[model samples]
Target: MRIAVTGREGQVARSLLATAPSGIEVITIGRPELDLANPASVLPALAAAQPDVIVSAAAYTAVDKAESEPESAFAVNAAGAGAVSEAAAKLGIPVIHLSTDYVFSGEKLAPYVETDPTGPISVYGSTKLEGELRVAAGNTDHVILRTAWVYSPFGANFVKTMLRLAETRDELRVVADQRGCPTSALDIADAILAIAARLKADPDPALRGTFHLTGTGEATWADFATEIFAQSRALGGNSATVTPITTAEYPTPARRPANSRLSGDKLAATYGIRLPGWKSSTEIAVKAILKNAI
Candidate 1:
């Protein structure tokens, strides 16, 4: 299958390029070719790529910075996402759109299901939520995959941030009150490929819809930090003491959900796919990032 993923450098897009099976052709389109911020650039680029499917993985991901740049976030995440979905529909192909756990208000006592009411508390979250709606509306063959706490060796994610900070700092303060699953971008790449395969095999209406796709386990930022440090220490990389702090202590311009853990049961039931536990994935990422540290 020829899969055209948006953005050549985003974590998920890079992971997809790295992990795609030999049988499938995964192309990463970016810049003048397929810039999300430039809607006019989308359709022609995808048409030229002639992909069997599209993976709408790129977006304005700066949570805090997005507060000051709502227009840019909406332009890329919402309007641009709609453009991609509409492009896919024009080509009569399926589009797998990556989303976030922030769609929820985090008020639910348990892990969120696909049916949970959405109440995004941040501009980033609100834009992503809008993107999901637009994708669904734009293409009947769209699959909106909501993930959380994504990290990989490829980008400026929490794992890399912690490692970079730990290189000089002995301890790190992380938000402990906000609970969510820490998903790996590499694992997400694998899941997206599998979902794309399912989409290719049959026109199963069951396969297309909003679903939660995250790591099997859950953790707070502190727990995730501790896990990263454990992996780093084991590999003789930079490690730090994880100091637990409440969200209020580390406030950002964007108000994050206190609980953004999303359940992957629906994805498993629908596509028969599940990502690895976050700790295990974190170990892999930390190893990749710190392989040459010693």
Candidate 2:
């Protein structure tokens, strides 16, 4: 399968490039040539790649900064996503979009199902929700995968941030009140490839739609940090004491979901795919990071 994934250096895009199986071609399109903020550039750049599938992995993902730059976020996440789907529709191909768990208000007690009502509390979440709608409207064949708390060997994610801080600080403060599934970009890449293959193989209506794709388990930022430190210590790398704090203690411009756990049951039943638990994936990611650092 020839897959043209948006964003040259996004965590998911980089993971997709690294994990794409043999016989599957994955091309990344980004910047000057293909800018998401400039929707007009999307079609031409993507069409030139002539991909069998388009993975819309690019987006304005600065959660806190998004509060100040709603227009920039909306332009990329909402309008940019719509353009990609429309381009795929014109080319008679399916689009697999990467969305977020932030679409929810984090008020629910249990893990969020696909049918749960969306009430995005922050500008970033609102723009993503709008993107989801536009993707559906622009292309009938679309796979919108909503994931949360994603980290990997690459990029500026929580896991990496924690490890970096541990290099200097013995103790780090993290929010304990807010919970989410700390997902690995590598695992997401594997799942995306599987879903993409399935989409190319079959035009089954049951296969295409919105689905929650996250790590098998959940954890708060503190819990996640604790686990990362544990893994790093195991690898003889940077380790830190995680000081748990509440949301009230650390305020941001964008209000995060207090409970961001999402259910992966639908994705499992449909695709026969389930990502590994966060701890295992975190260890693998930590090992990779540590190995690279050495």
In TM-score terms, which candidate is top? 2
Cα misplacement distance, residue 178 of candidate 2 (Å): 1.0
The collision pairs in model 1 are none
TM match of model 2 to true structure: 0.99
Assess every candidate by TM-score: 0.98, 0.99
Record all residue pairs in model 2 with backbone atoms less than 3 Å apart, i.e. clashing: none
Q: Candidate 1 lDDT (Cα, whole model)?
A: 0.92
Where model 2 places Cα greater than 4 Å from the true spot, the runs are none
On residues 113-177, what C-alpha lDDT tens digit does candidate 2 reach at each position?
Answer: 99999999999999999999999999999999999999999988988888889999999989999
- Across 1-294, the per-residue lDDT of candidate 1 in tens digits comes to 999999988999999989998899999998888888899999999999999999999999998899999999999999999999999999999999999998889999899999989999999999999999999999999899999999998978999999999989998999999999999999999999998988978898988899999999999999999989998888888899989999889878889899989999998887788888888898999999997455
Candidate 1 residues lying further than 4 Å off, grouped into runs, are: 292-294
Q: Cα miss at 181, model 2 (Å)?
A: 0.7
* Per-model CA lDDT versus the true structure: 0.92, 0.95
Model 2 worst lDDT window (10 residues) = 155-164
